[model samples]
Target chain A: MTVKELAEKMNLKIFCGETNLDRTIEGCYVSDLLSDVMGNAKSGMAWITLQTHQNVAAIASLKDLSCIILVKGFEPEEDTLQHAVEEEIPVLGTSQQTFETAGQVYQLIC
Target chain B: MVFEYPVQGGDFTNAGTVSSKVKKMMRQLGVDAGVIKRTIVALYEAEVNIVAHAYKGVITVQLDSDKIYIKLDDEGPGIPDINQAMQRGYSTASPEVREMGFGAGMGLPNIKANSDVLEVHSVVGKGTTVEITNNF
Candidate 1:
């Protein structure tokens, strides 16, 4: 499923990178630790994290992650949005907590 | 090709800039996707280590046909125990750095896991230098 489809299915808000909503989703990873995601998260995965920093977007872009899902009603910082838009990776948001949101994304993609 | 990038400690705003630039260079050089991914992970970890711990540092990357070599030399309060630092959960990062979701003590381990060869050198009250090699 594309990120756009998954977002609709899970009710994720599109914060930025609207141009990249069509990117295909290969898997999902839930983690707030940047190094954990950097070391382990695979390309094309939708990274679910509470981190709203600019480095999160840099890591997502460097790892070629399909998109980022900011959990628990967290919002991206201004720099975060800038990097996401620059990298063409979607920064998605949801009021759902990490576990629930990850579970839902896993169900849809896996 | 050899490239150098300077890293400033406590500069979270610019973390990963070097890694991104190196990733782009590898892409343009037509390095394999798998190699590029591993290299980015290792390189970014090293870059962040410098930013989170060092006063000043320089990352020198050497790209050759067989492998890519990266050396990060930093001036800081060097790791007293390299073995302990290599452990997954050990970290000496300040609280401020931890709040940024870094200093989880995974940086060195990540570099080890992703790179084919890794070596670290440090002296207390002096600095640390990490050498990583990822084969293409």
Candidate 2:
């Protein structure tokens, strides 16, 4: 499913990078640790995390992640949103926690 | 080609800038996708190390047809036990750094796992230098 489709299905808030919401999601990686995401996330996965910093956007870009889902109603920081906008990588949000979001996403994609 | 980028200590905002640039260059050069991914992962971890641990550092990248070589030289409190630091879950990062989702002790291991060759040289009081090479 594409990022837009997932957002719609999950009722996720699109914080930035609306232009690239059409990017395809190949898988999902749920991690709050930056190094874990950097080391293990696949190129096209949707990353679920509580990290709201600008480096979150940087890691998403470096790993070529399709989108970032901030869990538990968490939101991206201002600079994080700005970086996501500049990189055209969607920074998404949801009111659900990581486990619920991951389960739903897994059901949708898998 | 050769390129150099400077990294400042405690500069979380710009941590992955160099790796992003190098990834772009590799993609433009038509490097294999897998190779590019591994190189970027390794390079990014090394880059973050400088920002997390060192006062200042410089990354020198040499890109060739067969491989990409990256050397990070930093001025900071060097590692006294490279072996211990290489182990998983052996981070010495400050609480502030950990709060930012870094310093989980996975940085060097991640770098080693992604790179073909990983070399670390350091002196306790002075600094450290990390060398990473990945074959294309």
Model 1's DockQ score: 0.91
Summarize candidate 1's per-residue lDDT along A1-110 as a digit string, tens digits: 99999989988899998888899999888888999999989999999999999999999999999999999999999988988898898999999988899888878888
Each model's lDDT = 0.92, 0.95
Judge candidate 2 against the unseen true structure and give its global Cα lDDT, from 0 to 1: 0.95
Q: In model 1, where do residues sit more than 4 Å from their true spots?
A: none
Instruction: Residues A1-110, candidate 2: write the lDDT tens digits.
Output: 99999999999999988889899999999998999999999989999999999999999999999999999999898899889899888998999988899999999999
**Reference-based TM-score, model 2:** 0.98
Q: What is the C-alpha RMSD of each candidate to the true structure, in Å?
A: 1.0, 0.8
The CAPRI category of model 1 is high
Candidate 2's DockQ: 0.95
lDDT accuracy of residue B123 in candidate 1 = 99
lDDT for residue A17 in candidate 2, whole number 0-100: 82
Q: Model 1, residue B63: displacement in angstroms?
A: 1.2
